[model samples]
Target: MKAKTIFIVIVTVLLTIFLMDNKDAVDFNFIFVDDVPVSKLAVIGICILIGFVLGFLVGRPRKTYSSYNDEIEDNYPTEQPKSTLSDEDRDYIS
Candidate 1:
C-alpha cells in the first residue's frame, strides 16, 4: 500500500489501543465548577482536537507583498546625486 495509507492505518490502530486503555472515568475539577466525571479517552480526544484546531489557525500563512516596490515607505531620506563640478570647475571645463 501507499506510505500515506500505511501511516494512517498505524495511527488508527494506535489511537484505538489508546482509547481502549483510557476508557476509565476520571474526575476533573475546575475553579468555577464542581468535580465532573468524564472518560479519560474523551478528555484526551477533546484536547487533541483543540490542539489541532489551534495549530491550524496559528500556523496559517499570512499575506505579504512579493515585490520590493510594494513595500511600505519609511521616513528615511534617499541619497541625492552629488555634482562633481563647481562654478570655477565649470568655467575650466567650458
Candidate 2:
C-alpha cells in the first residue's frame, strides 16, 4: 500500500510537470462563449458553481456494509471463552 501511494504521487507529479511544460501544444480552446462578448464575472461565477458541486460530491463519505455492521455490533458486548478446568473435574463419578 505504501509503495502504491508513493508510485501514485510520483506519477501525478511527473504528469503535472509534463503537462505544464507542454501546455502550449494542447488545444483546449472553447468556442461556446469565447467568440461572443460575455461578462468575465459570469464565467467566473459558473466555474465556481461547477467546482462547488464537484467538491460536494467528492467530499461526501461513502457507506459500506462493514461500517453498518460495526455500528450494530458496538451496542452488544462480545462473549469470552471460559477457562479450562482441572483434569479431575472431567472424571465422571459413579
Candidate 3:
C-alpha cells in the first residue's frame, strides 16, 4: 500500500509539473509575482505537508492487549452459571 501511494504521488507530481510548464510557457511574467502563481513543486510540497498533518491529527493510537482484555471483561459478566446440568446429560448418544 505504501509503494502504491508513493507511485501515485510521483505520477501526480510529474503531471502537475507538466501542466504548470505548459501553462506558463506563454505567460512567463506570471511566475515572477509572489502571489500571482505558484510553482508546481511548491504546490505539491504543500499538499504533502498538509496530508501529513491531517493524517497525524486523525490517526488513532494503537491499542494494547491489556486494554482489549479489560474492555472484554467489562462487557462480559464473571458470575456463576445460570443453569445446572445432570451427570446423565453430560454424555451424548449417537
Candidate 4:
C-alpha cells in the first residue's frame, strides 16, 4: 500500500482505540452555549475533522497570479539545454 494509505490506516486505528477507551460523557462548552453534555467521542472526532480540513487547506498548492504591468522573465526556455557528452555515451544513445 502507499505511504499515505498506510498512515491513514494507522491514524484511524489509533483514533478508534482512543474513542473506545473514552466513551463517557463530558461537558462541552462553546461560544454561546453553557456546559452541554456530549460524548467525548463526538468532540474528539469533530476536532480531528476540523484539524484535517485546516491542514489540507494550508498544505494544498496554490496558483501564482501575475499582473499585466509586471515584467517577468521567461523561466522556461523553448530550446533544449546542451549537455557535454563523452564519445562512448553518444554512441550508446545513438
Candidate 5:
C-alpha cells in the first residue's frame, strides 16, 4: 500500500480506539457555562477540530509587497523598478 494509505489506516485505527475508550459522558465547563454534561468523545473531537481550523488559518499563504507587485506587473505590465546603481557598483557586484 502507499505510504499515505498506511498512515491514514493507522490514524483511523488509533482514532477509533480513542473514541471507544472515551465514550462516557462527563461534566464539561465552558467560559459562560458550568458543569454541562457532554460526551468525552465530542469534547475531544471539538477541540481537535478547533486546533485544525486555527492551524490552517495561521499557516495559510499570504502575499507580501514583492509578490503582489509581481502579480500586478505580470498582469498589467506597469512601470517596473529599475536599477539605480552606477556601472562601477554593478561591476563590483559582478
Candidate 6:
C-alpha cells in the first residue's frame, strides 16, 4: 500500500483504540455549575473537533494588497504619466 494509505490506517486504528479505551461515562463539573455526565470519548472528540474548526476559521487566507492592486491596474490605467492637477495647483508652493 501507499504511504498515505498506511498512515491513514494507522491513525484510524489508533483513534479506534483511543475511543474504546475512553467509553466510560464521566461526570464533569465546572465552578458554580451543575455536574454533567457524558462519555469520555465524546467530550475528547468534541473538543478536538472544535479546536480544528476554530484553527481553520482563524487561519483562513486574508485579502492581499498585491492581488487587489494587480486587478485594479489591469482594469484601470492612466492615459498619461503626469498628474491630472493643473499647473497652478501643482506649483502652488514651488
Best by lDDT: 5
Could you tell which candidate, 4 or 6, scores higher by lDDT? 4
Q: What does candidate 2's lDDT look like per residue over 20-83, in tens digits?
A: 4543322233756444544544554466569879999999999766776787679765775574
Residue pairs with backbone atoms closer than 3 Å in model 1 (clashes) = none
Ranking by TM-score: 4, 5, 1, 6, 2, 3
After superposition, candidate 4 runs with Cα above 4 Å error: 66-94
Question: Residue 5 error for model 1, in Å?
Answer: 5.5
Candidate 6 Cα lDDT to native = 0.85
Model 4, residue 73: distance off in Å is 6.7
Report how far off residue 7 is in candidate 6 (Å).
Answer: 4.5
Off by over 4 Å in 6: 1-9, 65-94
User: Candidate 1 local accuracy as lDDT?
Assistant: 0.83
Tell me the lDDT of model 6 at 64. Answer: 75
Q: TM-score of each candidate?
A: 0.56, 0.39, 0.38, 0.63, 0.57, 0.53
For candidate 6, lDDT tens digit of each residue in 4-93?
999979987897799889989989986787678889999888887798799999999987767877888888875657777888987995
Off by over 4 Å in 5: 1-5, 68-94
Clashes in candidate 2: how many? 0
Model 1 TM-score relative to the real fold: 0.56
Lowest lDDT sum, 10 consecutive residues, model 5, at 63-72
Output the worst ten-in-a-row residue range by lDDT, candidate 2: 20-29
Per-residue CA lDDT of candidate 4, range 1-94, in tens? 9999999999999999998888899998889999999999888888889999999999998976764434333555567778799889999999
- Model 5, span 51-92: residue lDDT tens: 879999999998666777688768885776788999999999
- lDDT (Cα atoms) of all candidates against the true structure: 0.83, 0.64, 0.66, 0.86, 0.88, 0.85
Residue pairs in steric clash, candidate 3?
none
The candidate that achieves the highest TM-score relative to the unseen native structure: 4
* Candidate 4, residue 31: lDDT: 94
Q: Please identify which of the two predictions, 2 or 4, would achieve the higher TM-score against the true structure.
A: 4
Per-residue CA lDDT of model 3 for 1-94, tens digit only, reads 6999999899888866765664331212445554445455556566777987999878968757678779888988878666566666665431
Every model's Cα RMSD, please? Answer: 9.0, 8.8, 7.0, 7.4, 8.5, 11.1
Clashes of each: 0, 0, 0, 0, 0, 0
RMSD of 6: 11.1
